[model samples]
Target chain A: MKLLRIYRALLTAQLQATAQYRAQAFLYVLFSVIRPIVFLAAWVAVANARGGSVGSFDVADFAGYFIALTLVSHLCMSWFAWEFEQDVAQGNLSPRLLRPLHPIHYAAAANISYKIVTSIGLLPILLLVAVSFHARFQTTLEHLLLFIPSMILAAVLSFLFDWVQASTAFWITRSSQVSFVLGRVSFIFGGQIAPLALLPGVLGTIAYALPFGYMLAVPADILRGGVDPARGLLLVGAQALWVLLFYAALQRVWRAGVREYSAVGA
Target chain B: MNAPVFVRDLAKSYRVHEREEGLGAAMRALVKRRYRDVRAVDGITFEIGEGEVVGFLGPNGAGKTTTLKMLAGLLYPTSGEATVLGHTPWLRESRFLTQITLLMGNRSQLVWDIPAADSFRVLQQIYEIGESDYRVRLDELSDLLDLGPLLHKPVRQLSLGERMKVEFAASLVHAPRVIFLDEPTIGLDVTAQTRIRRFVADYNRRTGATILLTSHYMDDVVALCRRVLVIHHGKLLYDGGLADLATRMAPYKLVVVTLADGASPRFDEFGEVVASEEGRTTVRVPRESAAERTAAIIRAFEQQVVDLSVEDPPIEEVIDRVFSGERPLSQVRS
Candidate 1:
């Protein structure tokens, strides 16, 4: 209960601060939509060139997949690797450590709040793309019901995984190269740039078994009308499993990293 | 009865990597690393009762800040046992964390881009304070610190003193029982320092909050703390009342004599001459022998002496002498 209230307050503050800079806020949200839209257009052109289908996905299907991918990507993204580096360099992290609450909670809240605001801006663009491309998605009550839960679980897994990665700041002075490599790997395997089913044979098999696909493609698949009862249940289970695994990793890294932090000032 | 903050043989040491200064050395360090042990807080022990304001005093690199970090639960001690309000600080349980606040002078925990009051709201949630309680505490703090106008200003827009005032209010909005302040008044102007000092004193008096403060400014120590613990080179030097420290380290009074004419006078028989001008002489006289020395000086210049006065040595001088470890009380008396 306390954590919830703290998150709400932090979210409110972040939104208000973002609102204060109207032009910058608008540009940020617009840029967020533009990136996925460009990706969607490029993939749609590819599907058209292939006579409107690629691995069982037509142009409409590509539209729905990319729209959902954008939303899921926004939910799962983590900037703390960069944020923590700056904080460590400027000695800002020291004050956070002195506070009562774990600093990760604040970071998580800020990330979620920014996503919520950005999603609001994304709604119109997503609707426009869906209507123009005639995207065919299963809008049944059952699919909607499962979609909500899947999105939530996907967010949890993403946050936990990003937190474990950010905790590396305590051990290394610079983790940007490591984070960059991890992000690139996730991009290829997580199905952010392409659907997992369309990947070459071996890569497709690897993506199905890894955590990255569960973070991006699973939720997108659910939104694109690909989740039957069995598959929906299986996707939810995978998300929960990843959440637990990543949470354990977060704990392990936090415990050992703090022990080595030295709390030294720059 | 107030609870005791107990620390048993606290020690904190770090293994810092060492590298020579050169491109070749840097390249070599990339392949082979060497480290040296730095004992930041070495085997020091002290205790404070609830509501007691204790000052941690030391020169730069004396481990004052490091010890405070341990007490505040920010850093794990290399080896030792410490408990704040009956709970090991490093465990940092939520219940314990909710009841404590730590403030650093150079750091502001409040959100930089927003008004300080907004930061208070976030802290309120973190502490789970009821709306009524939050408002009451905010009002009280605003009235005490005169934070009404400053509360709405972005923290970055405020001056150092103004920002510190807001920072102080933000830390206390939860009404923490134990406050750890590290140089809270550092880098502030004299008037601002006095204001902050008074606020701290009043806060302690009203709420009976236990305060452990570390500062390099002796005036801060003298103004807010009755008891001070001095450390140097990571070792505890003295832990006692301010007056006791002064008396223990310095046993002499400074005497200044004024003469009527612009002529140098011989007064070596009275005491050691610290300074002499055309018409005045300043001397350091043993505390016990102040009266005798004054009388002898008066007799020597019965017609020439215009005015004379005596006062205790400044605390800064006494501190310097204590840290040097050479100015013994007996030596000063003799």
Candidate 2:
């Protein structure tokens, strides 16, 4: 309860600070939308070339998948990796370490505040795109309900997973290179480049095997509806497992990272 | 445990990567980097009774800040132990943290883009300050620090001195009982520095907070700290009253004599002439012989000698000599 209050206060401060950059926030949301739209347009062109259908997707299905991808991507996003690198390098982490709370609370609050403030603009833009593209999304009450826990679990899992990667800044000077490479890896294997089902051969298998797929593609796939019941259960279970794993991993990494911090200098 | 702060042989060392300045050396370092251990805080120990403000004096890279960081729980000690308010500092329990604060002049805990009050609210939550207590404490701090006019301004918009005042209020919102201040007056104008020093003295008196402060300015030390811990190269060289440090490090006493007229009385024979003028002359004499020399000079020029006063060299000079290794550690360690 105390931690929640702290988070709320921190979140409030973050909101007020971020609100000053409303134009920049809108621009950032616009830029975030461009990627999915580009993917949607290219996939639509590919489907039209093949008699208006490819595998299990047509123009409308492609639009639905990509639009859902946009919303799902926004739901679980965080930026502590880049920020953490600067904090570690510039010794800004010193002030944070002085606080009673773990520094992660600050990052988490900032992440949530930025999302909440920007989503006001984001949701409207997404709705306009969905209508313009004639996107079709079908889901049952159960599927829609399942999407909530799955997305929440993915959000927590991906946050910690990325946070663990960012914590490498404590050990190595150029730790961002790890985050940088893993970023592209997550983009490809996490189903941002293409849906896991549409990937050919081993690529699809690799996507499912890695945690990245659960982060983006799995929750998104469930939201698009029409998945085998057993697979949905399996995906949600994997998402929960990843959350626990990263939770434990984050604890260990944070301890060792703090120890490593003393070793380095500050 | 009886003291508010205690440390036993506390030491901190860091293994830093070293590389030579050459493309070839850089490539070689990539394959096999050389590491050097910096004993930033060597085996040093001291205890502060409750409410005692001790000035931590050292030159650049002298481990003052490093020791403060360790005691404040920002860095773990490489070896040894420290207990602040009876809690092991490095453990960083919330109970322990709420009772302490480490303020760095070069760093800030306040959120940059927001008004300091907003940041203070966040801190208040973190420390679990109650509503009434928070309001009362902030009111007091505003009065003490002149923060009323500045609290609503964004931290980035405040002047350096104004920001520092607000910074003081932010760090103290928890009413930390143990405060570690690293160079609290650095980069501030003399008037601002005096205000901060005065505020610290007044705050310490009222709250009985144990403060360990590091500052380059001697005026800060002279004004606020009666007791000082002088360290060099991560080792404690002297720890005692400020006057004692000057006396021990600098073993000479300066005697200034004001003469009425024609008062030249072989001042060179008594000691080195530090300064000379038509009616005044200052001489540096060995500490042991200073009194005798002053008496003899007065007797020789009884009619001419109008006034005489003996004093130790300035504290900065003493500190400089210490850092310059004029006196060996074993000889000067108090």
Candidate 3:
């Protein structure tokens, strides 16, 4: 109950901070679409050039996959690692550390509030992209039901994944550079640039082996009608397992990292 | 001093990776890097009775902040035992944190671009202060710090002093029992500094909260703390009364004499002339002979010695002497 109150207050403050920097928030949501659109345009052009189809995907199918990837990517985005890097670098963590709450609450609230504020702009822009591209988001009630759990698990898993990276700030200064590479790897393996089915053999195997695909592509794949119900259940289980694994990793890493905290600038 | 803010052999040393400049050295450093242990706060210990507003005096990088960080549970001490309000600080149990506050003058908890009142609300929630109690404390602190006008203003809109005033309000909303203040008055104007010092002293008086404060500003120390712990280069050089500090570091006093006549009898026979200007001369005389020197100067100048008084050298000079090792730790009797 107390944690809930703390989360509420922090979320309010974060929302206000986001509101204050309207341009920055707009740019943040704006940039989320840029990558998916680039991929959509490229794949759709290829499909069109090949007489309107490439293997299992038509031009409309390419549009649907990347568009769904963009929306799901928005849900899975967790930049707490970058924020943690700044907090440690600026000695901002010192004040937060003295508080009774774990510093994670601050980042968690900020993450949610950023999405809430940016989603207002992003939802419309994504709708416009979908309309412009004639995106075919083919799905059924079962897929939608399965997507609900899959995306939630994916979001929680991504946060834990980023949190593990953020925990490195406890020992390594300017850890954001390393954190950025991990984020890029997620885009590569999480079906952001290409559909999971389209990923060449070894890359596909590697993506599924790692937690990144479950963190992103699994839910989008479910939403885009690419998976059977049995496979979707299995994928959701994999996401939950990944969430639990990353969560455990974060707990140990965060504890050790905090132990190594230099309390810089204080 | 049972259950007081206790400490025993507290120390914090950091293993800092070292590397040299130049591409060759950087390349070599990639394969093999050197390391050095910096004892930011070496083994030093002191106890403070509850309600004792003790000043931590030291020059920059004198382990003051490191010790405070350790005590506040922001940094784990390399080796030591410390308890504030009967709980180990470094463990940072929620109950322990609830009872203490660490305020850094250079750092802020207030969210920028938002009214300080909003940030205060967050603090209240974070501290789990009861709604009624939070309201009462907010009113009391706001009234005490004259934060009525500033609380509604965005933190970025407020002046540094105003922001500090709000910072104090935000930090104190929970009414922490042990306050670790690191340079809380830094960058504030004199009026703001005075107000904050008075607020701190008043807060301690009202609540009997133990306060350990570190500041380069001696006025802050002199105004609020009668007992001061002087740490130098990670060592506790002096731990005693502020008055005793002056006596220990500076065994001499200054005798300021106003000469009615521009030309005066040579005062060097009395002591060293520390300063002379505008028909006034100040001499540094041994503490023991200060009274006698004043009497002798009055007699020698006769009616020419218009006015004269004997006083200790400014506290800044005494503190400077302490830090500069004029009175080494071996000599400090504290």
Candidate 4:
């Protein structure tokens, strides 16, 4: 109970801090919205070039898919790798290590707070895109119930994966480069380039096999009614499994990272 | 019961990469680098009983901060055994951590963009301090430090002195039993430094907490710490009372003489002339000969000797001699 209160306090402080930089926060939301809109535009054009349908998706389907993708990705994204590297290199981790609280809570609180605070701006943009593009989304009571759990699981899975990657800083001085590589891989496999259905058959299968699709594509697909109840359950199971695996990985990485940190000095 | 803090042969070393200047050497180093072990805290042993305030004195790179980090559980000793409150510091168990705090003057743990008061609240939650207890402690700290209206300002907006006060307060929200302070007054003005020093003394007295403070200012040591540990080149040169360290390192007495008006007398024959001004001369002489030197000066100019006084050299000078290798380390006395 006490730890939860501490986490909430940290989260609230992070939200307040983020509010101080209004202009940067605006830019953050704008740029994040712009990327998926561009991808949505390309797919819409493709469906138009094909006279209303391309690879089982119409222009409306593309619109719904892309909008949902934008929302899910924004909610689940983790920028911890860069932040972690800066914290380690600048010796900012020293004060944190001295505190009794586990430092991961600080990072988790900040990440969650940023997402929640930015979602206010994001929701309006998502609505604007939905209206302007005439996107048609289909949903049911079952999908709504599953969507909440899927979104939460996706967030945990993404954060843990990024945290594990960020822990490479303990062993390598240039962990930022490693983070960049991992981020690029996530971008490609997490359905940023295109919906998994439209991706090459083999690549789509590979995306489903890995944890990337579970982070973005699965939640978005569920929200758009592209998944049936049976598949939705399977997706939720997969997300839970990935969450466990990545959580284990994070524990291992953090232990090694702390040992390296102490050995190397602050 | 064991001491609150104890160490046995605590040491730490780092493997540093070596490379020569030039593109060729850098390129070669990338292929194969040579590494050397730099011992930051060579084998040193010490102990501190509960409620003791010990000052750690050293020049830069003398491993004062490194030893503090080890004791605070922020660093693992390369080879040694250390315990704080009967718990191994490096393990960092919650039971041990809840009873200790570490404050670095140069760094801060507060959220930078928010008000420091908000950060204090966050600390209250983190340490699980009860509402009434938190309020009482905060009120006491605020009154002690004269933190009026500074807590509401954003941390980045606060001056260095104010921010340091907030940092100090935030670290103590839990009323830690053992506190590690690393240069708690590094860059403060004279008044601010004095405020922090007085606060430290008062807090120690009130709580009976064990404090290990490291500072470059000698006054900080003289005012708060009876015992001090002096380190040089990663070695413990002395560990004893501050006054004893001074007496052992500086076995000389400073004599200031004010000659009679219009009568200048030669004082170099008696001792080393540290300074000479209009009719007033300050001389430094061996402790054993200070009396003889003063008597000889009075006899030489019975009418010219207006005033004379003998005193120990300043602590700064004694520390300077120790750092400059003027006084051999083996001469240290406990």
Candidate 5:
């Protein structure tokens, strides 16, 4: 209960603080939409030129996939890898270590709060695009019911993975490289560049095996009604397992990092 | 009860990599890095009782801040045991952390973009300060530190002094029982330094918080700390009353003699003439012979002497002598 209250206060403070940089926040959200829209436009053009069907996707299907992809990508995101690297390098982590609360609470609160605020700017733009494209979204009661938990699990999984990456700052100076590589790898394998269905032969198999798929592609697939019941349940199970694995990894990394911090005198 | 802050042979060492400033050396370091053990805090032990404010004095790289960090639970001691409020510091239990705060002048914990009061609110939740107590405590600290107008302004918008005042208030929002201040007044003007020193003294008096402070400014220690721990090269050289240390290390008194107007009497015969300005001569006399020297000067120039007074030299000179190795640790021990 105490931790909960602290997170709430942290979140409230973050939102108010972030609200001050209105132009920066709006521009960031505005730019985030550009990539997904560009992908949507290209795929739509392909479908139209090829008589409204590219593989298993029609023009409406392309619109729904990219639009859902945009929302899911924004919802499941973490920046603390590079943020923690700076904090470690600049010795800003000292004051935080002295506080009663674990520093993760601050980072987590800031992440959740920033996403909440940015989404306000992002969702409206997404809705406008959805309306303009006349996107036909497959909405089933089962998918709707499963989508909420899957998205939430995806977020938790993403946060944990990012923290694991960030914790490397304690051991290595160039820890940001880890997050950079993670971002590129996830874009390729996590269903960001193209849906797992569109990936060539063995690549699709590789995506299903990695945690990145659970982070992005799984939620998008479930929401778009692309996966069958058995596969969807399997994907959800994979996400839970990844979350647990990362949680364990996070604990181990944090312990080792703190030990290193003590030896080096942060 | 145990001392509010206690340590026994507490020590900290860092293994730092040494690299030459060249591309070739950097490449060689990548394959096999050479490490050297730098002993930051080398077996220094002392206890600070409740409400006691002790100045931690040292020059650059003298391990003052390193010791403070260990006591604050921010850094683990490589060897020996340390406890703040009876709990092992490095364990960092929430209960333990709630009772301590480490404030660094160069680093601030306050959220930079928000008003300081909002940051205070966040601390309140972290420390689980009750709403009623939080209100009362915030009001009290704000009043004490003169943070009324500064509390609402964004931290980035406030002046250095204003931000420091807010820093003080924010650290005390939880009413920590033990406070570790690392150069809390660094980079502030003289007036701001004085205000902060006074605020520290007042806060200690009111709440009886055991404060361990490190500052480059001697005025801060002289004004607020009656007791001090002086360290040199990572070793505790002296730990006692400030005046006692000064008297032991600098065994001399400065005698200021004022002659009659236009009376240009030679003072070198009496003692070491430290300064001669406007018919007044300042003499440095051995502590044992201060009174005798004064009487001899009075007798020799009874008619010429207008006024005379003897006092111990300033604390800064004594500390400098200690750091410069003029006053060896053996002298203090003796």
Candidate 6:
């Protein structure tokens, strides 16, 4: 209970910090919203140009998928790689380690808070994109109910995956290059750039099994009415499995990483 | 009775990769790395009692901070055992953590770009302090540290000293029973250093909080700690009262004599003359022989003496002597 309270406090403090730099925060949200909107437009052009449908997705279906994709991607994005680099360079990680709460909680809380504040602008932008594309969305009570759990699980899985990547800071002095490569891979394989079904057969199969797809693609697929109810349940199960697996990996990396931290310089 | 902050033969050594000059060496290091053991904290044992403010004194890289890190549970000792407050430090149980706080000078735990009051509120949540208790302690710290005006300003806008005062306040909101202060007054001006010193003294007096402080400044040790544990090359050298350290390491007093006329006095018979200037002479005499030397110097200057005084050597000189291994306390006393 105390740990939970501390997480709340850390989250609140991060939100206030983000608020203090309103111009930067505003620009960040704008950039985040613009990137997805552009992708939505490109996919719309492709679907329309290709005779109004690609595979099972029409232009409306593309719109729905991209809109949900934007939301999930925004909520799940983890900046821990950059954050860890700065903290290590500046010796700020020392104080965090001194705290009773696991340092991951601090990272997780800040990420969650930033996502919540950024999502305010994001939701409306997503709605605007959906309206422009005349997307067909499922607003059934059941789907809406499932969306909550799915999004939550997606966020956790994303955070854990990024955390394991960030923990590479222990062995490698510069993990930014690694992070960049992982990010590019995630963009292609996690269905951020396009729906998994749109990819070639072998790549699509690989994407479905990898942890990357469970982070954003699975959640987005559930929301876009791309999957039937049975498959939706299966996707949820896949997300849960990845969450557990990634969480375990996260713990292992954290334990080893702290031992490897040199706590160098001043 | 409280359990000792025990450590039985604790050690921490790092296998640092050795890199030589030249591109070839760098490339070779990437594949078949050469490693050297940097024993930061060698096997040592000591225990600190509850509520004892012990100063951990050492020059840079003397393993003071390394040991403190181990005790704070930030690092795992390579070998041996260390239990703080009856709990293994590296395990970092929340109960043990709630009773301790670590403050590194010029390093902030408070949120940047926000008012310090907001950071305090965040700490309130982090430590799970009741609202009433938080407010009470906030008001008390504000009054004590003169934090009223600084509370509402963004942390970046505050001066270094102002920021440190707020940092100290933030660390104390939980009223921790044990505090580890690593150069807590570092990078601060004299006025700010004095203010923090006073604050630390008052806090310890009021709450009886155990403090382990590290600083390069000897003045800080003199002003705040009656007992200090000195470490050199990762080895414990001396652990006792500050005055005892000075007395043990330095057994000589300096005597300066000024002649009434513009003439240098010959005091070689009295002691070893260290310096001589116009109408003045300085000499070092054994502490045991100081009184006798002073009388002899007085007799010699009876017709021409203007002024004379005797004092112990500066603490820094004594510390230098100790570091140089010139005067181990045992040898000095013998």
Highest TM-score among the candidates is held by which one?
2
How does residue B191 of candidate 6 score in lDDT?
93
lDDT per residue (tens digit) for residues B185-304 in model 3: 999999999999999989999889999999988899999999999888898888899988888878899999888757655789999998888778999999888888888888888878
Identify the superior model by TM-score, candidate 3 or candidate 6: 3
Listed in order, the DockQ scores are 0.59, 0.66, 0.81, 0.65, 0.66, 0.61
Error of 5 at A241 (Å): 0.6
B94-165 per-residue lDDT for model 1 (tens digits) = 777878888889887887788887888898887888999998899999988998889888888999999999
Q: Write down the RMSD of all candidates, one decimal each.
A: 2.8, 1.6, 1.8, 1.8, 1.9, 2.5
Best by DockQ: 3
lDDT of 6 by residue, B5-32 (tens): 7777788897887889999998898789
Predicted complex 5: CAPRI docking category: medium
lDDT by residue (B1-334, candidate 4, tens digit) is 2999999999999778898899999999988999999999999999999999999999988999889988988877899899999999888888888899989888878998999888887888878889999989999999999887988999999999999998898888799999999899989999999999999999999999999999999999999999999999888998999878768889899998898774556788989999888888889999889899889888888877878899889999999998998887788645
Off by over 4 Å in 4: A262-266
Question: What tens-digit string does per-residue lDDT give for candidate 6 at A1-266?
Answer: 77777777777778888766667767887887777778878887887898888888888888888888888888888889877876775567887787666888878877877877777777887788788889888656666666778889999888888888888877777876788998899888999888998898799999987888888888888777677767788888888998999888888988888877766543
Q: Model 3, residue B216: displacement in angstroms?
A: 1.3
lDDT (Cα, tens digit) per residue for candidate 3, span A1-266: 88888888988888988888889988888788998898888988888899998778898888878778888889888888888888887788898888888887887888889889888999899889888988887789999999999989999998888888888887777788777887779778988878878888799999999888987788988898878889999999999899888889988898788788888888
Docking class of 1: medium
**Residue A74 in candidate 3 has what lDDT?**
91
Query: What overall lDDT goes with each candidate model?
Result: 0.82, 0.88, 0.87, 0.88, 0.87, 0.82
lDDT of 2 at B292: 95
Candidate 6 regions with alpha-carbon error over 4 angstroms:
A1-4, B1-4, B261-263, B275-280, B324-334
Candidate 3 — which residues are off by over 4 angstroms?
Answer: B20-24
The window of 10 residues in a row where model 1 chain B has the poorest summed lDDT is B325-334
TM-score of 4: 0.96
Model 1, position B3: C-alpha lDDT score: 62
TM-scores for all candidates? 0.93, 0.97, 0.96, 0.96, 0.96, 0.93
